[model samples]
Target: MGDSASRSRVSYPVFQDVNHMVIFGFGFFLTFLKRYGFSSTGFNLLIIVLGVQCSVLIEDLLIFLLQREDENSLKRITNAVVSMTAVVISTGALLGKTNPVQLILMTVVEIIVFHMSRWINETFLQVPDNLSMTHVHLFGAYFGLAVSSRFSEPLPRSEKNASTPKSDLLSMLGTLFLWVFWPSFNSVLAVDKSKAIYNTYFALAVSAVTAFLLSVLTTKDGKFRMTHIQSAVLAGGVTVGYAGHGIKYPWIAMILGLLASVISILGSYCLQRCLNPALKIHDSSGVHFTFGLPGVLGALAQVVLTVINNWTNSARQGHLVTVHIGAFCLTVSVALITGFITGLILNLKLFKTIPVSKYFEDQLYWEFPHLAVGF
Candidate 1:
């Protein structure tokens, strides 16, 4: 009995407190960075990020709050309030802006950010642990890459199907609220009106076309399907982001985005099928390290794309070829090092901690009885 009790104690919830602390610390650091670099543009971007974060939190909070009541009615109320607030704020801010074009551009960017955030939260946080990490990561990567493709996939029934039409309407309104704020998130930084317009429309067009194609090819049953269009959009966007200012080859952006989307989907599938089973770990959280690997790859891709574009442009202009090699190297090195250190700190539990509530256990049983068996 004593030995059995000790073993049970050892297995009891050791990670929750640590996980909470790491998340809060990360949020604090992000907040600090934003404030330190505060400017009109920076402030707006920070708000946009915060808005995305808040949107998720609000949804979760509303659902939790309504769980004991009429789930349908409470959900409807939550959606309505969230949607109204978003619409009011966005409309007010854009009104009387110096450049209507800039406002419109910012709105589009905000929509992308909003969608990415939702996709990450849903694919990573909401799913059962039995689902492999590769599955979650692939979902997230493809979703992000799909942004450049400009496609509108249907919301998951889990996300969209509420108890009532009113609830569904509210949920959609909240989504639209996100759509309205998206463009402003990044486009506010663009100095040239023409460039801003081009970037905004271009991103939207790519995303829309990719989404449309996916919808056409996908079966009516709504099973998620991977395609090359998603990769093309992401790669294209990354390429354009690196050198769009100087390069006239906007098509390069689309091509690269398409390629990235394909690679991301295929890589994720391969990782899940080939690598995950061998490791014996299921669930995305268990494979957190794998998810982060793409960020490193993305940084490298950005560097290579930027250098090539710069070199090509410089050759055409016959400019003195003094590269800011030190600055570029330092930036990438610092970013990589910082990311590594941060991951280590979180894993090591060098910061504060939080305790998962016992109440959550009941929730696990109620919402996912089968999953509750494993816990």
Candidate 2:
């Protein structure tokens, strides 16, 4: 009756925004694949389920053990959404590579590692980041990429992960869902009348457009690639997450969006044409461009904005610089090492797993009941 009566609940609309983003946004986003629609959406559903269940338990238990308190229902739900989002980002890099059961197991190990990293940085590293670009986005991308590199099998060049008219249309539904609600997604945590939210909303719109235009312009023959457009348009949200609270100007948001969109398109090109093969990593959803590098850009933006805002605070500046560096090193090292170990454990073959050749297609897992096959 003491603190319970006085505690404020998260706004209903904010919770709803994050909810839709996770469900419709992430699910449909993966459906862009031409052949792997079944596996793509199905696997996403699986991981979300698995990740949610395990995330609650792991997070709550850690809270009890470490903080010596029990979490309330609302907090658990909110944190569960955040945890699932991180898992979903990680899954993008390993899409079509693992079966339902394998992905479930991976979720278990991943939640453990994910929470551990978040806790260490928050509790010990004292990093000025909560859902910071480095913590949530980059951490998942690098972790998934590491796992993909170690154990993921590549889709053959002859294989089709390309988009069909219907598939592409469906994919856009996912994009639209994500794009429409993105402002809410970014601004939900901010105070009312927050510059962060304002900047975030505008930045999202600008990036989406810039990403679309740049995607068309940057292709080898100047033709638009769906992958680039899909991945890069979201970079705006990532960039503005840096200092949305302090960034009072829309032009700055535009500039950041423009730059992030360019980098995202370029990241897609290089990752697809060059890095994937040379690095021996099979990134199924091209998450590096979409979520990974943009997040890094966000981290950079954080530094730039901090400097521009408070250039005269020498001692505070020194402390922030040190914390940022430490945070980066900690996030990268833990993500890579922990992800590699998780992949190894996933490779143990205790479970009956699907062959790598059957990676992307839907028949291996989901049942499609309605299509009439011809002789």
Candidate 3:
């Protein structure tokens, strides 16, 4: 009994670490572009704080509305952080494209959508998942991407290509913060404490190694790019979370990491080459590669390979395989529809508008050192 209690004690530190990842990881990682430092940190701060607060309320109300007995303040806050991470992921898709108020509105809509989807999954579907890929990664990425596509047309690059030595270094700091704490982020939800934690760490190491090697392998000059380092290295966790848990052998996780890393690296490259020029789809942090593709594909791949009866035996699963598929489809549809509507609302004339020329520059949104309003 004491051992069980001790294992549960890990929750507090897990909360602290995930908080660091958000406060530091998400903010500074997006600071790679030299010009957008203020928007990256300042607006990110605004949007994420709003996400956390709204998550607190939505999650609490959800508990009461559903009449859950085991739910408590600590669990609600933990879930709020998890949901807030999803919000942060969505914001990555719209980074530098929209203003602060737009994001606040989007966050409110997203949290409500997220909880609704979650409630359906919990109440009707009850499928157990070992990773955040579904809850946090896939929904946020796709939701943000859908919203971004709506706001996008044939617009010239809303952002600039300004990466300095210092910006790169700071980006690495954010990467380091994310990489170190990700195990805790994933492990916080683990039911089998020891094995799940081991799987998380193993997957992180393999994915980092794979992402680094693949990143180097694909680059023309054999020089490491911060984009790959800052993002794809974390695919190890995503890959593991996707479906590698409880496999009879351990090396399979390494292979999954390798595949996920390769896809992530190429996905980023393709978005830069094909999407930006053709459609002005500017994913500021290339989150599609790190979070979107990996999460969706991982979930699909796991579903394909996993035995339905097997999953039924896992905790909380009470439905047929078709129900799980329906839940995924429902979540995706709701996210896209909500995101599109949110984009339309942002485009309405009620909000403060940012000039095209000053899209990525911090001066438009913030008062800082020698802030210059674009003519």
Candidate 4:
């Protein structure tokens, strides 16, 4: 009963779109590493497979513990897919610096924490973020950064960390897939599904344009970086995540998208250089800019919209704003503490961590052809 029946009816097709984003979109998106293609795509597949199964089990266990009725099959699958997404985003930040065993272990720990945080946001705080503003994107990004910070050795500059022309092309393919499917992703649980879709589409289109323009302008040579194109172009979707379901105007989505693109592209151009040395965080795929900051922007946008909608009632406005901010703070705190602990566990000698010398090379895990011509 309730919203579950209706959610189930429309869930599958959108689920397929989101699943595509997880599989092909994310899989290839991380393939920008020239020598780490196999690890990038292969590790992503392994994590998603493990994450989905674990997430479903954890969600079901939690529901039973809470004495709540079970979600329908479709809804459960949808939630599992979404749960895996946070792990995938976190993986992006830790890519090339982690071994397969370490990644598998991290996936399990992160999924457990993610589901618990999600439950708290939904049950205790009644967070209204349909697109997982704080619970997924923000938490995933910061958690990965936190884990990366635990490494004693910084990610060294090496040829293997650089992308080849072919790898960049593959990464762009992933970006296009995400750009095309993101509207379906944002609208899956929206109250006004059509409006969510429309707003998300508008936001993405604008963000893409802004990313391209800035990439050229920001560089001394006035050339576009494949990194910016691959990552920054998608910030619009993250920025509009919480707002997509309720925003009443196309202009609002466009403005949010524009701001998100600027922040993401600028972070990559400026912040990425100093962030590692300054904070001891080595972000492999710039997740902090692409997901973290845009997520914060989206969360704030949602709070502003909540205020606007309840302007006539000061008491109601204050309560809703408090809930929104409280949820964000809780999600950040839980993710950082849990992620830091997980990092400490992974740092122990027993985990068989990746060596600094083998950071971004697929040869450590994958076999290659004698020539391996294009790769």
Candidate 5:
């Protein structure tokens, strides 16, 4: 028993140490890239890519935490909490200037836009049958970044599925490293470095706290389940895109955070039913697209609202409505065309090698032994 205990203790710290090393390496690489004359635009683009990747990684972490128990869950929880706490504490200590009001307002705007987009997608646009708001948001963020960076299509589903324990572990390391440098990414070109630093740190703190509390409260069977926290964090982050430029109200951010969380929960519940009449898919291994109609509509709704906002903002700034409309139309057209081309490209070659028959056979053999022969 003593030996076992010693081994257990050593294992966790070793895992943590490895995680730190990976993070350090990644940070050094990014720093080196910056020092080697990488453009400011390149740095911004890197942040956007890394941020979306981190978002996906965080989602995976939540799922892992939920699926694990005892020491595994505890270890995951400790890592998440400690990493976030370190970010918040260090930011507070290092950069103490921030606008609380602007922060709050930005948070609220983000939450509202996020939920509104989900609502719109659920109500209209038949894109797919099983897409969730979270998925849609992720797609939008990734899609947006891809457009901004002029990259090829996003990572394929097969590649994502092939992710293993080691890769996932590396992803967590990546997430923490991103968290540490988020302020720079968010505010790199800002005239007010002080405010940018403060806002970025504050948002990170809120996201971490919100994620932790939600994990604890919403988890079932020792697994970290999805909750309103996901939406809240995304909404808060997106809101920063706009609100960060305006007022920095913490209360507004908190209110937005709460609203986003509630709306995400309610919207997901309602849309899950509407879009998934057969309810064949489970959220256990990630949302399946076979039942993703409502999710498509949700995505459309978000697109519409964003269009309207852009139009209004541009008009207010005395730009031609045609320009705004043209821009929106161009963006949508490009996204659709690019997404299609990329999806096709990715589906070629080895992507087609994932034998569906084999997968189904394995599922029958292992997941439903009693029903494998149609008992």
Candidate 6:
């Protein structure tokens, strides 16, 4: 028992860090609405708790049935919580628009699909580590977008969807938590923790600097937009998700960080406006810019590095390249399709969807003091 406890204690730091990211980090990250603060954090808490329970059961059951083996309880729980991170990302897209019931249903369904996709990627494609980026980040972002595309209600002229100074400040706290702990997130399943941490730390540092610079340049009055800082600043962390473990040089990580920040800032500031009309996706939290694109960039970086290594070593690892490409394509297709179908189910009249007038408001879900309500 003492030996078992000692082994468990060794993994505690990473588990604690990931737990913080999933709860406090993501919970506060969603609290950016002027009036929807209660729902944002409250519903997020709901989804996460349920995800932790449901994901573990699903993952364990799948492993038992398919592989006829059981995984360590701690490892399964940790991965389950990490899987919830993707569900939280998806929740970000449909934030103010979804009712609690819809959110709960989405959480349950997404977890099943998430694990299924993960199994396929790891087992069939033989791309185990890469699933962290493709299955979680890429899958989460596109899944949310697919669901968003299915529900096309326009924000009413009177809707209180814009963030206030206080709300944005709270949201920044979430961003800081994610930023400080993201190296742990990127390096959680890595073979070499030191290399992963080194690359991720540099990448995130440069990404933060680049986000600030781009935020200033993009805005007319040279002011940093809270939105960019909250979202784009984390792109570097996402950029190193898959490649961090393999990245040897700090410079390469820095360059990837620079590129990721540019793409995130541009996508958030420019492409985001075009999403509704062009793709019919109403991503409430810009997850595509922050998680989806940066994740793909990270996965591509891994592929490129693999090709270069093959060339230099005179080795033919075409199978590896095929795995990366196949994993990417398969992840996109599964996430979007499953998400769209889930949206369609949630939209059924039985679900009792939120009315348009109540969008982004806390009154529908939370109780406030009479004095606060009057104000």
Top-TM-score candidate index? 6
TM-score of each: 0.36, 0.90, 0.87, 0.94, 0.39, 0.95
lDDT of 3 by residue, 168-278 (tens): 888889888887887677666666545545666776777788777876788889977767877878876765664544544556656666667777888888878887668
Ranking by TM-score: 6, 4, 2, 3, 5, 1
- Model 3 segments more than 4 A misplaced: 1-10, 128-133, 153-161, 275-280, 308-320, 369-375
TM-score of 3: 0.87
* lDDT (Cα atoms) of all candidates against the true structure: 0.32, 0.74, 0.71, 0.86, 0.35, 0.86
For residue 309, model 5's alpha carbon misses the true position, in angstroms, by 14
Model 2, which residues run further than 4 Å from truth?
A: 1-10, 68-72, 128-134, 191-193, 220-223, 370-375
lDDT digits (tens) for residues 272-348 of candidate 2: 78888898888877778888888888877877777776689988887776666677678878888988887777777
Residue 306 accuracy (lDDT) in model 5: 45
Clash pairs, model 3 backbone = none
Angstrom error at residue 137, model 5? 8.8
lDDT per residue (tens digit) for residues 20-84 in model 6: 99899999998988998998888888899999999888866877787857766777788888899
Candidate 3 vs candidate 6, TM-score winner: 6
> What TM-score does candidate 2 reach?
0.90
Candidate 4 lDDT over residue span 293-328, tens digit each: 999898899899999999999999999999889888
